[model samples]
Each structure stands twice: as C-alpha cells, then as structure tokens.
Target: MLIGDVARRSGVSARMLRHYDALGLVRPTGRSHAGYREYSSKDIQRIFHIESLRSLGLSLREVRRALEDPSFTPAELVADLIRQTRERIAAETELLTRLRRIDAVEPSGWEDVFQIVALLQALGSKSAGKRQSAALSSVDDVPLPVEALVEAALSESDPNVAGALRWALAQSGEESLALLAEGLGSPAAEVRARAVQSIAEMPNDGATTLLREALTTPDLVVRRHAALALGVRGVADAVPTLIDMVVEGTNDVDAADALSALATRPASAKRIATKLADRLAEDGVEPPARRRLTQALADIPGPTASKALTDLSHDEDREVALTATYILGLRAAR
Candidate 1:
C-alpha cells in the first residue's frame, strides 16, 4: 500500500505518516516502480504497533526504543508513564479547583480576579505570617471563598494562622458551617478538632445546631469542643459531656467553667449539681477526681449544690472534707 492508502485505512494523517517516516520511526519497507514510497505488510504492522504505543502516552523516542531496541524493557517505561499520567491528572484537578474557586468569587473585573488569586496563593504560602495576613485580609473588599477559608482552617498547623483562618470562616456566616461540619467527619483528629473549634466561633443558630449534633460524635475531643461551645450558648444538652470532660480531666478547667455558666439558669443548676454529685459518688471515683468534682460544685448555687457540699463536708477523705468545708464556709460568708 502507498502512503495515501495507509493514511486512509489507518486513520494516520498523510502529514503525520511523512513525519514518522522522516523520523525513521515507521519507514515503508519498499518503493513502488513509480518511485513512490510503498508499505509492505510488515511495515503496516509496525505502524499499528507504533500507534498502539503512542496511545499509551509513549513519546516518539520511547516508541522507537520500544519497537527497535533489543535491550529496551517496557516494565519500567510503563510504570514511568503511569506515574506521569497520574501527575498530569493531579495538576489538572488542582487547576480546575483553582478555576472553580476564582469563579466562585464572582470577580467584577480582571483586577478583582487577580486580587482573589493573589490572596488564595498567599493562603497556601509556606510562611505562616503570609498565610495569617492572607486570612486577615480575606474579608477585605472582596471576601475570600468560604471553601478556601475552611480548607486553610482544617490544614493549618500554626496556631495564629489557624485562628485567623477560623475567624475568617466565621465571618462568612452560616455558609461556612456545612464545610466545617464536613471537616468534623474527617479521619484526622486534628482536622476534626479544628472543625469543632471553628464552629464554636460561629455564633449563628446553624452553627449551634451543628455543634449540638457533634455532641454525639465518637471522637472524645470533638465531643468536648462541641459540648463547651453548646454550653456557652446555654444549650443544656451539653451538660453531660461537659461533666464527662471534668471526669476525664481533659480540659477539665474549661469544662468546669462551662458547667458553671450553664448552672446560672435556675432550671439547670439542680440538674448540673446532681450529675456532679453522682460522678462524685461513683465507685472508684479516686481522690483527685473527687476533689476536682467537689471543687466544680462550689460555683453551682441552689439547695441541691448546697446540700451536696454539706454531705461532702463530712466525708471520710480529709482533703475532700476540708475542700468541701472551705467551699461551704465561702457560701455561708456570701
């Protein structure tokens, strides 16, 4: 077959066939009597082989080596091609995400687009100062996309930068709540904690609702953050987890403070006192934990708290009884 016929049948363009021939990649094996390049059956098979290899992302040079070099091994080359393809896909995906974020900004002009891109790049910068500055400036003239803020908040390791990111996200209002909630489900404990912390800063009812839901998560850290946030919002449902935080001695001080805040409400004071007293009475409650629980009761008012302290005042442990006596004395002095 002539070059034209091969091009027609194989779907390879005439120009590309000539380029292949010029590169000595798929030269025809014979010449027609009319002094034209002609392809033998073996040459046609070689062209198909070249096309097949090219489809797998092989460069022309690699294709030639694959077809002609006896020492060439395809295993390593194939693995390299797989790696390159994966890299290309990742690059494309990142570019697409960037474009989507830019579009989400609803830029009014090219200058606005440039500014948004600059801020986004800064958010991902290696310098913590740059990231924090970017986060602080994000709520400027053009607000950064909430998604970008959430992503930064979840991954940030620097405490200051993370706080700025969380602040920026909170400014975005309830829209940031969904992404932050999704972060709560992340397998990384740090990410989940960040999500809960960020949610805690959002004062909207949506955030409060999500925090209430987070109270039941399997992660103890997540639950503690949620409970503290909820307790501050006067959500009585958080009382149990806040009490648990005290018992486990995880952020127990903050937990106690939250409980005291919740106890200010008349209806919650007795219930909070009862839970604390029960934990105090549990078998093997330990001396230190008992002391901590006893101290926790000092802030709670109402007869429930007063009577519990009165009962603890006569307890067997000297420190416990003394601590309770000191608290009751302070209450009496009031």
Candidate 2:
C-alpha cells in the first residue's frame, strides 16, 4: 500500500505518518518504480501498533521505545500510566467540585466567582489562621455554599479553625444540616464527632432534628454532643444520654449543666432527680461516678432532688457523702 492508501485505511493522517517516518518510528519498507514512498504489509502493521500504544496514553517516544527496545518492560510503564491517569482524574474531580460549589452560590458576576474561588482556596489553606479567616469571612460577601463550610468543619483539626468553621456552618442554618447528616454517618470516628459538634452550634429545628437522630447513633462522642445540644433546647429526650455522659466522665460537667438547664421546668426537674437517684441505686456505681452524680444533683431543684441529696449525704464513701452534704447545705441556704 502507498502512503495515501495507508493513511486513508489506518485513520493515521498523512502528516503524522510523515512525522513517524522522520522519527524512523515507521519507515516505508519499499519504493515504487515511480519513486514515491511505498509501504509493505508489515510497515502498515507497525503503524497500527503505534496507534494502539498511543491510545493507552503513551507518548511517541515511549511508543518508539515500547515497539523497538528488546528489553523494554510494559509493567512499569503501564503502572505509571495508571498513576498519571488517576492524578488527572483527581484534579478534574476537584475542579468540578469547586465549579459546582461556585455555581450553587449563584454568583452574580466574574468578580463574585473570583471572590468565591479565593475564599475556597483559603478554606483549604495549610495555615490555620488563613483558614479561620476564610471561615469568618465566608458570610460577609459572596455566600459560600454550605457544602464547603460543612466539608471544612468536618476535617478541621485546629481548635480555633474548627470553631470558626462550625460558626460559619451555623450561620447557614438548615442548609448545612443535610451535609452534616452525611458526616454523622461517616465511618471515621473523628468525622462523626466533628459533625455532631458542628450541629450542636446550630439552634434551628432542623439542627435539633439531626441532633435527636444523632442521639441514636452508636458513637458515644456523637451521642454526648447531641444530648448536650438537645438539653439546651429543652428536649427531654436528651435526659438519659446526658446522664450517661456524667457517669462515663466524658464532658461530664457540660452534661451536668445541660441537665440542670432541663431541670428548671417543674416536671422535668422531678423526673431528672428520679433518674439520678436510680443511677445511685445501681449495684455497680463507682465512688468517682457516684460522687459526680451527687454533684450533678446540686443544681436540680424540687423535693425529689432534695430527698436524693439528703440520702447521699450519709453515703459510705467519704467523698460522695461530703459532696452530697455540701450540696444539701447550698440548697438549704437558697
């Protein structure tokens, strides 16, 4: 076949075939009596091989080395191609996510797009200060999509930056709640904890609903945080988990405070006192946890709490007895 026929038949353009010829990658195996370049069947076969390699993202040089080098191994080259392809895919995915976030915000012009892009870059910054600043400024100008704030809040490790991110997410109200719900179900314990903490900052009904759901989650961290949030909202369902937090010594003080807040109501105060008394009655209650429980009852009002306090004042453990005595005196003086 002549070069024209080979180009037409193989789908390799004539210019590309000439370039392959110049590079000695594929040369015409024969010449016609008319003096034009001519290719034998084997030469056309080589052109097909080069095209096949290029389709796998092989550079022309790599293709030449692949076809001509006797000792060339494809395993390493194929692995490298796979790695490169994965990197390219990751970059494209990140770009697409950013574009979608920007579009979701409904940017009014190029300036809004540029501002949002800058803010997003800052949110992902290596510097904690920069990230915190970005989070604080997120609501000032172009409203960033809640998804970005939720993403940042879930992964943030620094305490100050995490607080800022959580605050930013709270400002978005219910918008951040759905995204945070996904984080609550994440397999990573840290992510689930962060999700709960962020949700705890939002005071809306949607956030309250998520916290109620989080109370049922198996993660103790999630359950504790959700209970605390629920307690402040006057949701009595959090009462049991809040009591558990006190016994477990995880954020026990905050849990106690939440319980006290709920105890301000007449019926809730009586019910809370009964629950505390029940824990005291449990067979395996330890001195430390028992003492903590006694202290928790100090802030709760009503005759049930006073009776529970009165019984604890004469307990066998000196610390529990003293704590209960001190609380009784404080309640009596009031």
User: Highest TM-score: which candidate?
Assistant: 1
lDDT per residue (tens digit) for residues 1-334 in model 1 = 9999999999999999999999999888889999888999898898899999999999999999988888788887888999999999999999998899999989999998999999999999999999999999998998788888999999999999999998888789888888888999999999999999999999999999999999999998899999999888999999989888888788889999999999987778999999999999999888888998999999998899999999999999999999999999999999
Pick out the ten consecutive residues of candidate 1 with the lowest summed lDDT: 68-77
lDDT tens per residue, model 2, 10-32:
99999999999999999899889
Each model's TM-score? 0.97, 0.95
lDDT of 2 at 46: 95
- How does each model score on lDDT? 0.92, 0.92
Poorest stretch of ten by lDDT in candidate 2: 68-77
Clashing pairs in 1: none
Error of 2 at 183 (Å): 0.8
Candidate 1: where is the Cα deviation over 4 Å?
Answer: none
Count of clashing pairs, candidate 1: 0
Cα RMSD to the true fold for all candidates: 1.2, 1.5
Q: At residue 19, give the lDDT of candidate 2.
A: 98
